[model samples]
Target: MQRYKCTISYDGTLFSGYQVQPQKRTVQSEIEEALKKLHKGSPIRITASGRTDAGVHARGQVIHFDSPLHIPEDKWVNALHSLLPDDIAVKKVEKAAPDFHARFDATGKEYRYFVRLSNYKDPFTRHYQFQYGYPLDIKQMKAAADYLVGTHDFTSFCSAKTEVEDRVRTILRVGIEMSREQLMFRFVGDGFLYNMVRILVGTLLETGRGLHQPEDMKTILAGKDRSLAGKTAAAHGLYLWEVFY
Candidate 1:
């Protein structure tokens, strides 16, 4: 058997999420079903770098799967593409190191969130970005994000549904950029809890809207209470931008 590491891009608008479900379509289920078909009904499972919630997209998501078939790396991509749906595409596939694991060996990840700064939503980007209409103060948001750049217990930013109790994680960077129509929030971190990125963005948005001071981020983090943070931003506006091994 050989392990193949594949990078893929997907539109998650219609899927339940990345994981498999009994009666719902998911990214993993789709890819595994294709693999099983190719393997002549033999079951095949894939391990992804991480899971994305419903309505979240991915630009360069990675996964590794062990296969008994000895297909060429280039042909693997073509074979999978033929059987996969239009929303998901395998970008590249190659034999991976024997010990490599898609999720376990990951060193870092980067997530991006988009919010439009317009009075009305654009037809082309309505599904891709949040339509926040209000003016945002980038300076205040930046100041708030600065406090999130180091290692800390992020209990406040995680979702209540998360079962992981070790809330400490390291954040490498938090940055924001503006275009003609929207604002982009980028987060590079060692790891993130469930809904952490969305919650962090929501908190920063409050600061940008003058509802909270920049220094309030420090207090929020120190409090370690989810209720003290801002609302969880919509999942549709977020993307799994990259993963580092």
Candidate 2:
């Protein structure tokens, strides 16, 4: 058997989530179904870099699977494209080392969130971007984000439901950029806990509205309390941008 890595993109509007669940339509179920069809009754399991919540999209999601077929790299992409649903597209496929794992081998990830800053909502983008008409102080948000970059315990920014005991993670960078009426928040980190990115975004938005001082982020981090953070941002506005191995 040979291991193959694939890069894919998906629109997450109609699915339950990334992981498979009983009697529920999910991204993993859809892709595994396509693989089952390709193998003509044989089961093939794939491993993804990570899971995304319902309504959270992906532009550069990566996965790896073992296959016995001798198909070329380009043909693998074409074959999967023909089998997958319209919402999911396979962008590229390549042979990977036999022991390489999509999740365990990943070194870092980048996530992006989009917010619409206009009063008039565009029907096409309503499902993709969060609409926030209130004015945001960009400078304040940037200042607050600066406090989050670096290695630290992120218990305050994660969901209470997270089961992992190690809440420490390293954030490489945080970027806030505006283009026209659209605002983009970019985060690159070694890893993230459950709902960490959404919670961080929510807190930054609150800071922009003067709900908290820019330096309050430091206090929230040092306190290590989830309740101290702002509400979780909507999942539809977030995208898994890329995974680095």
Candidate 3:
């Protein structure tokens, strides 16, 4: 058997989430179904770099699976493309080391969130961007984001539903960019806890809206209390932008 790595993109609007669930559609279920069909009755399971919640999208999600077939890498992409649903696209396929794991081997990840700046809801982007019409102070947001950089315990930013005990993670960078139509928040980190990115975005947004001072981020981080953070941002606006190996 050989291990193959595939970089994929998906429109998660219709997916229950990335993981398989009983009687519900998911990204993993769809890809595994396609692989099972390709194997002509044999089952194949894929390991993704991480999971995305419902309505969250991905532009560069990575997964790895073991297969006995000898098909060329390009053909693997074509084969999976023909079998997957229209919402999912296999962007690239390549042979990987036998011991390489999509999740455990990942070095870092980048996530991006988009927010609509205007009150006029564009039907075209409703599923892709979070609609937030309130005035936001970009400078204040940036100032608040600065405190998030570097290694720190992020219990305050994580969702209470998360079971992971290690709340410490390193954030390489945090960027806030705005255009006439929308604002984009970018986060590059070693790893993230459940809902960490969404919570971070929500907190920064609150700072931008004058609900909190820019320096309040430091206090929140020190508090390590989830309730001290802002509301969790909508999942639809978030994207798993990339996984760094």
Residue range 133-212, candidate 3, lDDT tens digits: 88999999999999999999999999988899999999999999988878999999999999999999999989989998
Candidate 3 or 2, higher lDDT: 3
State each model's CA lDDT, in order: 0.93, 0.95, 0.96
After superposing candidate 1 on the true structure, give the runs of residues whose Cα lies further than 4 Å from its correct spot. Answer: none
* TM-score for predicted model 3 compared with the true structure: 0.99
Best by lDDT: 3
RMSD of each: 0.9, 0.7, 0.6
The TM-score obtained by model 2 is 0.99
Compose the digit string of candidate 1's lDDT tens values, residues 1-245.
Answer: 99989999999899899999899999999999999999999999899999998899998899999999999988988899999999999998989988889999999999999998889758988778988988888999999999999999999899988899899999999989998978999999999999999999999998999998999888999999999999999988999999998
- Clashing pairs for model 1 are none
lDDT of 2 by residue, 125-238 (tens): 987998888799999999999999999999999999999999999999999999999999999999999999999999999999999888999999999999999999999999
Stretches of candidate 3 off by over 4 Å are none
Error of 3 at 45 (Å): 0.7
Arranged by lDDT with the best first, the candidates are 3, 2, 1
